[model samples]
Target: MTGQSLLLIDGFNLLSRAHFATSYNRTDDQLKNSKGMYTNALRVFYQKIFNLIRDHRITHLSVVWDVKRDETARRKKYPFYKATRFELPEPLIHQYETCKAASDAIGIHQISLSPYEADDLMGALSKKWSGGDCYIYSNDHDLFQLLSETTSQIIAGKQGEYVYSLSHFQADYGIAPEQWVDVKALLGDSSDNIPGCPGIGEKSALPLIQHYGSLERIYENIEQLEPGLSRLKKKLIQGKETALLSRELSQITCDIAELDPLLMDDLKVSIRKDVLGEWLEQMELKIRIDSYGA
Candidate 1:
């Protein structure tokens, strides 16, 4: 087992959290530089990244960002997916490029696939580099599916950070982590606007998927199940199509070929005091400039 762990961060998730945490609205929360460029998002983002590296003793880091939502394959397959999400703040949108640049300058590996969501990239990368022991940082429950012997997830909870390892995932769900996609397919994800099987939820779905292994298997042995779950069987039969489609939507694509190994090698975090201080000064964050350290 490698002592080194690669940290994969969900860039948009953290960016939005930082953006909202700092300011309530676009008008009043804007932290501008002398040239009036919005710097609040990047400032908070850098500090968070710095803390993660310092606290975790992480050396390899990758920041995976979501491309435009409309450009994603999921949106094309399901038009109503994520339709309930509010529009991103314009100020936050404006600062995205700068934030990416700041991260790049900080020497962290940054990845963004034009039409794929960051979750997919993270999943693919995690699987690709599992031998190195990968830890993904995201609050999105959908990512729980990616947990494995060599991969885990760190979630920010109200109390503190929660680390979900493969064993922990199995114990919590009573099934392997990979089965999470099937569970979500049956229960649906309200946040992503995925309409799963009607009336099926964690209570009902977890056990069903755990028993059958997958949606296909469940349907194949439908006759065997109706005797035990007569009422739920009816709902399952009724929502079979929805369940199948939801599975496709809930599953993160791991076939993505986004990260080049050589490029990923270049992403090792190395703090350059001069560049770090320059960026902080530019953002008018002089007070926090010294935190990155030499």
Candidate 2:
């Protein structure tokens, strides 16, 4: 939790983004049938991620996935949340599956459990990471809550290859990562389809939450808020139950009941040169390494 470097990648996140980017540059019919020409995109992205892990010299590595979206946790909260993102183009969708296979062949572990998301899996595993900084390779803002307990950040922006450390998250958001849930609760998440206080955006949310320390507290003293915010508080009161429920739904769960990282002995391993070479050959990716570099 303190000084460890563990790479927790959101497998589908990388795959979907790669697919969309790959599709933009190449037509689907061409990519699947080409001389493994299109596989390079997936390879290059994985290679970059692999190199980042190598450069950081992580003690543990795990790729997290949302196996199926039909979890009791999510369905119980808001049935329609993330309903549409499930559909993805065929070429990139296939590539996402291939990437999982490639990761396995390379000895990197991919983790998924029933009803839990990759973010939650990372959060739980991150708690067990000992020493150094733990990183999550996702652009998902939900992960920011874990920053309170572990060194947390997301792989963000268009390419999503850039790693955002704790400081980088704060710099980008105008508030610390720990305050992310509060921020989301106030501003609401259209992506996740969680509704927040109708009028509260980042500007007003930060000061009110910072002053009061939590949404619950601010709501408890709704009468004393700034005149503008006071009017907005009425909206929060109406949706109070839903807002709190959304807050719970939005935060990544670090306490998974059944899964234990201690059982995973393959957590520490290096990617083999022969395996990497064979996969690259099959995928037809370029080698930045010399023939000897693997």
User: What clash count goes with each model?
Assistant: 0, 4
Candidate 1 structure quality by residue, lDDT tens digits, 54-157: 66667678889998888999997778989999888776887788888876785667888867899999988887774376889889999998988878888888
* TM-score list, all predictions: 0.91, 0.85
Which 10-residue window in model 1 sums to the lowest lDDT?
285-294
Please estimate how well model 2 matches the true structure, expressed as its whole-model Cα lDDT: 0.69
Range of the 10 consecutive residues with the lowest summed lDDT in candidate 2: 285-294
**Candidate number of the best TM-score:** 1
TM for candidate 2 is 0.85
Candidate 2 ranges beyond 4 A from true positions: 1-4, 33-41, 148-150, 158-163, 167-178, 261-265, 289-294
